[model samples]
Target: MHNIPIRNLSARLVDPFQREYYYLRLSITDVCNFRCNYCLPNGYQPHPERDKFLNVDEIRRVVRAFAAMGTEKVRLTGGEPTLRKDFVEIVENIADMENIHTLALTTNGYRMAKDVAAWRKAGITSINVSVDSLNSRQFHRITGEDKFDDVMRGIERAFDVGYQKIKINSVLMKDYNDGELAQFLAWIKHRPIQMRFIELMQTGEMDHFFQRHHLSGQLLADKLVQQGWQLQPKGRTDGPAKVFSHPDYQGEIGLIMPYEKHFCTSCNRLRVSAKGKLHLCLFGEEGTDIRDLLQSDNQQLLLQARLFAALQGKREHHYLHQGDSGVRTNLASIGG
Candidate 1:
């Protein structure tokens, strides 16, 4: 229903640094089923309070405010967003927004084979699935799940259902899947998939694991460049991945190196936790609660005002390089 001109809406989301945010990462839930070694190694623990995640109405209010303020892309994320019974309804609600041109999902691929077609019908424009390793055993070891075949089938199902291109996210770790770059590249050579190698990031609860397995994404990026993969320019709402393409292959490669210098200068996205907290930075301090203002559709102006005021406090860059992970205990908590 927001018929506001794009030019006017764009100015409202700009921060003091003059960076305009057009992307929003909204987490729908924090309960994940998989126990990834680097993230929720012990699986998701139910909070004592059992806090309720944002309902459909709340989600609509949040999306409405952001869309009205020039957010063109909205990504539905979670510890496992598909776990929600109303997941499809959530997608439809956001898809109904006229201002949101891109509706994406970041999933673990556990449900892709069975639910992807339904997801596509509900309006997910893009999909990114986490595939830590190509090897079945290695994937099981890294993710603590024995669903490698299931995930692979899910990818195939996505393509069979008309998805032209899919993005695969792999978290690179030392002595782990780090040696499988060539294997990954070869697999994606003829496929329309973007294989993204994400550097293992340090979090408060996983410092020991991070220290043991952290691998630099730059190594992979440099290797790709040397192999004739040309770097591609990023879109305004693109994530931090440095994408590269090769003339000989139908696929592409993306490197997400958070440790690299000037990593946050091109930031165009903001994150909101499943419980309605606004996170200025992925590795920043505690989030600012914006849920109170999301109670009603009439709170749109106040919500936007709170968002603009909060954006001013966003630091230019995260202190991840200085061994500071801020208050984030795990990536799944904030839908990272």
Candidate 2:
């Protein structure tokens, strides 16, 4: 069966990037469990605080509508996706939709110790766990919660729950965790996890880190090469990470340069934030608010208008222009 629901709209679906954006990211909540320095503002902007949020049933309807509009892959995200009360129910509901091909989630993994099996039972086959440091002290420094043991327990539980592939995401910042890149990479080697080294974007609370220290993906890949591991490049795809592999290892590693450049022009995905806002571009300041439409269950012309705006919002590329593209926010709010 065709993964997209575009049978009615395919003829009009002229992919500006030569392929339809097959991926959809649905942020179920903006609330996270960790107080990562790079994520929330000091102690002021806590995770439990509400800006605007969506109900589980409301999110299911939105995903169903997206499935009808030709989206096939859906990944649930959040400040921490697992924090939502009906997190597993949301996953199961989306998985039951025939149009969705892949269902995934990215999380901080601090809360998955006991719930991992339940998460798997909900039909999630893959997971990406965000771990910036393996060192306990440094880890606590970054997340403000020395729940390293908890995070590791989650990883173990993910494997026990039968998650096919697990990728570990490590954000590289100068002096902070950059010194531990090789350590982090080596830690995941031979394991069921792919190690991803992400460059710190000058967004969110990470602005403090960006000004204080810096590093790049190219540099990290080079470091791996020096350690006698062959960095084999994987061809680009709509998926987030720009993948690479180690010749002798079973996992992969990657870098996503959202600030330096975005995979936009060819961008095929759109984000429905937990707050019921449609963000076409991760860096796009404008979010088409569909909260009212979602609340009223209005599937009128406005729905199509929102889709049009989302498509029109797709730029040939992100504003990685040398000086001042003005994306100072961090990945926390965007659900990366």
> Which number leads on lDDT?
1
Across 1-336, the per-residue lDDT of candidate 2 in tens digits comes to: 224443453222224565566678888876777877766645325456546578876787677667666777788897888887788878887787866777888888987888989888898867888888899898888888889999999998888778767888787777778877657667767776778777666664455567787676777656666766664554332466666666666676777766555445456778888888877777656677877766544452356456655675455666644433345366666586
Model 1 lDDT on a 0 to 1 scale: 0.91
In model 1, where do residues sit more than 4 Å from their true spots?
Answer: 1-11
Q: How close is candidate 2 to the true structure, as a TM-score?
A: 0.87
TM-score of each: 0.97, 0.87
**What are the lDDT figures for the candidates, one per model?**
0.91, 0.71
lDDT of 2: 0.71
Alpha-carbon deviation at 315 in model 1, angstroms: 0.5
Residue 326 lDDT in candidate 2? 44
Give the candidate number with the greatest TM-score.
Answer: 1
Model 1 residue-pair collision total:
0
